[model samples]
Target: MNASPQFRVLRSRATETHNNLREEILAALESIIFESYHNSFTIRADLEVAFAAEVQSKFAVAAHSGTMSLFLALRACDIGPGDEVITVANSDISTTGAISQCGAIPVLCDVLANDYTINTDLVERSITDKTRAIMPVDMHGHPANVKALRPLADHYNLRIVEDAALAAGACDYGLPVGAFADVTVFSFSPFKPLGSSGNGAMLVTNDEEICDKLRLLVGYGHDPLRHGVKDGYQNYTAEGYNVPLDALEAAVLSVKLPYLKEWTAKRRAIVAALQDGLAGAPARLPSFRPESAPTFRSYMICVDRQFEIYQGLRAAGIEAAFSYAPPIYQYSVYAGAFPNSNELKVTDRLAKELVNLPITPEFSDSDVEYMIETTKDLLEKT
Candidate 1:
């Protein structure tokens, strides 16, 4: 039998980018070997500057993982026990996990039927005295109703921590996703659009005070006390966690940052082709406003017989999938811990219908044609 189509989801082009930056990586490695690996004033520090600029933010704080970025963002927003943070139910577990880790209640909300982002209308009603913040994730590399949510958050005097993990190069209304929220978090997991060689994430913001708090929080609550110690003691100012990005990952991310826009464009091109080809197919594809652009992190579509199609695709050597079926509350672990919005009809419907297909930038014309024809063929047969 022929090999299955290597449909690697959230595929990272890190290998290609790293190969291009081979000499730089080696030089950075040698520098680390000789200088004993300084986390600050090195590749990691440079990355903070470069990445912050790429995201159009005034400050960027690197972290060990995206979850850490989200946790710190939530903490910076003063979300914790008794404080409710409204967010969508259909997303990577990381989204809600960050809220839960910070001791905040994640009030699950439904996603819009068209784009599968947070229902901005549900947000205002969900806000009570305890709702301290609203975390709108950039679902499927497309902007949520973040701008619409801004008014609600402002009216309620709540913070907004945007999760742009899958939207590294996406823009909303001409502004990068990172530039529009109180604090925006981007993940560099190997699968993300702007992934690192390994794992890394960034928290970007324009607010100096929040930046200061996050910077200090990542370093065991050290109060801006530089490399050495004052009076032979490092002051632990607040309860914090030690979560800084690795220098090596930073080095890799630095190399890939420049190509992010090009890569995102490629993903968009492929999505356009697929959408055009599958015009009348029996699946609901993602839709967005003209002002917003998505990286098409994954091509999410809704269809009946989703499981049957998913299994058939796998059997036919495709890596098609349904990213977050059943939403969060439906998961066995948190079945009873969280309540599904009383009217998550669309969320529940999508839980059974949505499927993610290969939309990588590296896809060749033939590769994409194969995906389109294969999907159309499968849909017709099913």
Candidate 2:
């Protein structure tokens, strides 16, 4: 069966945006080829400046991916083996993997049913003497309850790392997503709100000491200058990993950053349209908190008959997805890694019911209407 005309039209618009960016990317590559001398540090510095301006932070460190950004942030804060980090269960497995890579245990907490963000109450209850930090993931562009979570962290003397990968342009209570946490990480993968042509991620913090340590950690533990130390010259510091973001990705991100707000606004508008259209449908729309403005990274709806609906949407030639199905806790790798794995009730429920629909600046009003109508029809039949 052919895709709905509305679906085809919007998909074509997305393709056009991608193709235009590809052309710009090729032009950038040609310019780089012609340059007599390319200094990577100079490019990094420029990106740092651009990121600081965008997020209103003192320092921003670019890395190869968001996973590395999280690892670097945790390492900077001195979290490692024998420590536990409290985080949401309904998140990408990369969050858990990053914690594991640091040799820290990830204590998964259930999310709020409405927003799918970490339940601050569960986060507090999960804390232990071994707990080192609280990493709150801003799922699908909605900022977590940072104000409430920050106080909880302070009470426990724990650091906070905001996983702002899906929330580049989102803000909570007028503050940017990166503003409140001790350290915040943002991903610029092709699907993110502020994406580049390829993969990139960044860490931002107001603490100069943490920023300094992160710079060394992401740069293979070597001091930038390689200056003299007690024994002739010693530049290497802590044990670290090489996770620098490439120059090309940085350039592309710089180009895309300026349009992030506009793109995010368009996404939010689409979400509103979807909500209006699905008012009488069986699907449960995600609740928007007035205090925080979501950037709508992925427009998700929870519905009964999730699997059937997912298959139905695909059969109808619409591109829909199950975001984070088989919650991180259900992964084989996490089978017995932690003790309280089965406590994620809400996470389990969401994993079984959530469905993400097409959400992009390229999606048109008619496209959203078709999805809404198709979904209602599918649900009625089931």
| Best model number under TM-score | 1
Residue 20, model 2: lDDT of 61
- Window of ten residues with lowest summed lDDT in model 2: 6-15
Cα TM-score of candidate 2: 0.92
TM-score of each: 0.93, 0.92
Q: Rate the local accuracy (lDDT) of all candidates.
A: 0.81, 0.81
Cα error of candidate 1 at position 382, Å: 4.0
Judged by whole-model lDDT over C-alpha atoms, candidate 1 comes out at: 0.81
TM-score of 1: 0.93
Model 2 lDDT on a 0 to 1 scale: 0.81
- Candidate 2 C-alpha lDDT tens digits along 49-114: 888788899988898889889988998999999899998877888898888999999998888888
